[model samples]
Target: MALWTMSFLLTGCVIKQHQSLSFCETASPIYISRDDVLTQETKRQILAHDVVGERVCGWGRSNHTS
Candidate 1:
């Protein structure tokens, strides 16, 4: 009984995996480049609430931090 149930569950997972691949094929492409990203000046003015001095996400300091 357990073996039969396991096989049924595995077959359902395989079918869902094929469907996911088809969905991905119809999705739009994403382009990411340094130039396409925002500049420091724009970030300061637009994302002021999220910015604190020069720290962003506890990573590096901003250009004005020094």
Candidate 2:
């Protein structure tokens, strides 16, 4: 019983750490195109909704190559 409890606690801690690490690793800057026809107000709302608690690193047009 004691071993099972210890294992459960360790598993929970590992899962929590993994989630945080993954969030940081995947939190890259998002690019928004000027040609998308999005108003400033609309853009702010979209970013706020998508990013939630995370800070946006940067925003601008994404360069594309043919």
Candidate 3:
């Protein structure tokens, strides 16, 4: 009986994982105007955030759409 129940649980069970679960959104913007100057380290961090947002749960973006 226990084996039958376990089989049933395995057949249709799904694990939904969200990227945001792994990464939290930044409270402040990582980037500023294009005219603003950024240090190399800052640029790298921004790029990393952008790449993650593109492929992941769509975090790291402005609160509203442009």
Q: Lowest-lDDT window of 10 residues in candidate 3?
A: 21-30
lDDT digits (tens) for residues 1-66 of candidate 2: 999999999987774434345444565444456567888997787676446425443333233233
Candidate 3 regions exceeding 4 Å error are 1-31, 58-66
- The clash count for each model shown is 0, 0, 0
Error of 1 at 40 (Å): 30
lDDT (CA) per prediction: 0.47, 0.57, 0.63
RMSD of each: 11.3, 7.4, 8.5
User: Candidate 1 at 27: error in angstroms?
Assistant: 17
lDDT of 1 at 10: 92
Model 2 regions more than 4 Å off: 1-22, 39-41, 46-66
Name the better of 1 and 2 by lDDT. Answer: 2
TM-score of each: 0.23, 0.29, 0.40
Mind giving the per-residue lDDT tens digits that candidate 1 earns over 1-66?
999999999988874434344423343323234555777985656445334322424323323221
Maximum-TM-score candidate: 3
